[model samples]
Target: MTKVFRLKDLDCANCAAKMEHCLNKIDAINHVSVNFLTQKMVIEADENEFETVMQEVVKVCKKIEPDCKIIM
Candidate 1:
């Protein structure tokens, strides 16, 4: 399944790439697409672990960019 999330404080393509990379590292994630211009992240993962992966995504994103916010 796929989910879309809005991100705050993501001001550049590099930051978006970083966020994508962070999410892609998760074993549960099948794919990730982050667009800084739209401040959105499209995540594909196992349906059963969707919530868990989303929580981890937020955690990892914040770790990479402390000011970033994931709007679920």
Candidate 2:
């Protein structure tokens, strides 16, 4: 399953890159991209585990940028 989410207050390109790298490390996530310029995120994961994968995505993003929000 693939979903696109708007990002709020994503601080920098470096953070976006870090978020992309970390999110892609998840076993359940097939792919992920964080675009700082566009303030958007695209995630691809197993349909059955999409919700759960998003929860992890949020956590990982927060760790990198505390004020950043992934608009569901």
Candidate 3:
């Protein structure tokens, strides 16, 4: 399954890379792509792990940028 999220406060390339890196660290996340230019993040993972992945994503995103949001 895949999900697209709209993230805020993505003002730099480094922020985008950090978001990608944090999401990639989750074992349930099979893939992650962040478009800094568009302030979007696409995540791919197993259906069974969707909830878990999203939860982790929220936590990671808050850690990286508290102002960011996952546009579920």
Per-model TM-score versus the true fold = 0.91, 0.97, 0.89
Q: Which rank order by TM-score, best down to worst? A: 2, 1, 3
Worst 10 residues of 2 by lDDT: 51-60
Tens-digit lDDT track for model 2 on 1-72?
889999999989999999999999999999998999999999999999999998999999999999999899
Residue-level lDDT tens digits of model 3 in 1-72:
988888777777887899899889899999999889989999999999899889998999888878777777
lDDT agreement with native, every candidate = 0.87, 0.94, 0.87
What's the candidate order when arranged by decreasing lDDT?
2, 1, 3
Better of 1 and 3 by lDDT: 1
Give me the overall lDDT of model 3.
0.87
TM-score of candidate 1 to 2 decimals = 0.91
In candidate 3, which residue ranges exceed 4 Å CA deviation? none
Provide C-alpha RMSD values for all models, in order: 1.0, 0.5, 1.1
